[model samples]
Target: MTQSKEIKKPSSGLAARIFRQQMFIPLAALFLLALFNFIMDPSFYRISFDYNSVGNPVLSGNIISILDAGSELAILAIGMTLVTAATGGQDISVGAAIAISGSVVLRVLCGTNSRPDTLQAPIFVAILVSCVVAMLFGAFNGMLVAYFRIQPMVATLILFTAGRSIAAWINNNELPIISDPSFGVFGGFIPGIPIPTPIFIAAGCMIVIALVLRFTNLGLYVQSVGINESSSRLNGLNPAFIKFLTFVVLGLCVAVAGLIKVSRFSSINYSVVAKDIEMDAILAVALGGNALSGGKFNMKASIIGAYVIQFLATTLYKFKVQSTALPAYKAVVVILLVVLSAPKVREYLARIGKQIRQKTHVKEAG
Candidate 1:
């Protein structure tokens, strides 16, 4: 009986530890969703190799497709994670910002001609200029929020309303189609690579950010500012500078996402490019077990959350759900996940755990 009780204690403790993990909730949801998909169709997660129109090898399947599609959101989520960590606020203008950047890329490419065949000197210039434009836009939001002490949502709302129009104006209200084949490599696949290039781009961004966070004091400083700006300042950290820097990083991410979006179709539609992505980016951050109120963050969890969102959307469409109705269904699931990850729910679970342990101890003693 004593041996049995000891064994049960270890198992219970292990279960409790697993449940306490920050990534546990999102991981569990992803697992359950994957299971559901498998049950619905045994081949849902299967991957296969195929040749593209250009005779290049490519990975094709639902699972690979989901990851490929989620790349843009995943990249945006990393920036959103940093911004949320430093400012305790989410950016509502990321979608608009993406539009502006995408337009900049095309506007520069189309300079001197509507469609250029070869990758000219102008493409590189366009990429640089677009990234700068995005950074400036981000700085504007930072100034409003940090310098003027405006709320992030309200501050970014200005760009949210006019960013698309600004993008349209940049391109003279023309939807430019890029005629370069090499440009598609960023969004599609390279000759020797079977996986999508956006996956590599997203992975590279994550790696760079991960290394920065791991090797430097930026992570600590950002968390300090987010947790308490006064305390951060008193500790000799520049809270305002940290906040501004975070927005700039987000702007860079916006440029990358925009470039990928344009490369995907080799075209830009100012009206619909990157529409409503801010919602997905915020949802990814929240579902990743990070607090919306700010402070500490986990980038890996957020990336997983992004993929989960894409998977959910893909699954919904597989079930014959209409495009318009997809948002409603996804929202319902997101709300439930967010509520389950709430601090109150976690505290209650902790309380119940203690009670259960106490009951088990009493039983063993008796």
Candidate 2:
């Protein structure tokens, strides 16, 4: 009986430790949000849905928008996570890639001279073309980084600035409207609920990526190469090939996210569609509990980070204390949140908590 108890105790402790490290930050953030909202307004728990309104009532009252914000983060962070893991690098041109994706779709489907109703292409073909363009761009970055050993930032930086210019050149820096029935799937809504098509697309991407990384030997190869390229190569894993592949996938993700952005706005402004979106992607990856050094990547954690960021933004706007300084406020909160969210820090607290409990029990016995 004693031996069984001991085994179970250790297992339980290990599980608790794991949950605390992974879940604490997101849960605490949500708790703080609830407490703050409750303190500010007693009816913070209020929830409602009205589907019968004539001019189209929101299905879940913007819940889809919150998820949509997270979806953008998920797509960008997928690339960031892979690159950071494989090559020990960060791709700063994430936003630029996204701009190119949206711009290409708009220009091809809805040219500046053409109305939103102009061009009609199959969705799969459009997506495939965008993915190819994104892959070429990402491959360009990989060549520089892998062959010349350039800083990942600098290598991607070349495209980061130039890519936007190229997108603007295509669009004449104007917003192009999207009216194809195929494109409309992205923003379609069921009577009571606004189904953000982008959100579903993003979810599909997450499923595909998760499936790829979880069930394949390729996942093992990338992780081994990420931890140590030389050893992985000696063991016959090709680091160069993995890095190249990761960037290509990253670019594809950026491209899809861009398409969604354009769809959401119903137009593409080459300049405005993806400004500073790279920051959101990076922050999402970090907030998802990834280390700056990289080795492990967690899709679910990243997804949560995306949602958390959006949640914070929405919570702020809902309070109506809106101001331009909100970004600054968000920055500060994120910094603090990130610090507290560290796995090491969470472990330390759990240790202290266990010690304190032991002492309290001893005192009671005495």
Candidate 2 residue-wise lDDT, 1-366, digit = tens: 323324456875775666667555666666687678679876545544545444446445434557766677777777787887777778888788878877777777764464656565666676777778888888998888777789788898898889888888778877667665556556454344455566777789989988987888766776777788889889987788888888888888888887777767767666666777777777776777766565666667776777777777777777774646567868998788776776678779778866765666577579
Taking all chains together, each candidate's TM-score versus the true structure is 0.94, 0.84
The CA lDDT of each predicted structure is 0.90, 0.73
Backbone clash tally (model 1): 0
Could you give candidate 1's per-residue lDDT for residues 1-366 as a string of tens digits? Answer: 334435677876777688878899779989999999988899897899989889999999998889899999999999999999999999999999999999888878777555766644566788899899999999999988889989999999999999999999988887878878877888999888999999999999999999999999988999999999999899999999999999999999999999999999999888888888999999999989988889999889988999999999999988999988999999899989877778798799889867766777788789
Name the regions of candidate 1 deviating beyond 4 angstroms: 1-7, 116-120, 352-366
User: What TM-score would candidate 2 get against the native?
Assistant: 0.84
Which candidate number would show the highest TM-score if scored against the true structure? 1
Residue ranges of candidate 2 with Cα displaced over 4 Å: 1-16, 34-58, 111-116, 120-123, 179-182, 188-194, 321-323, 341-366
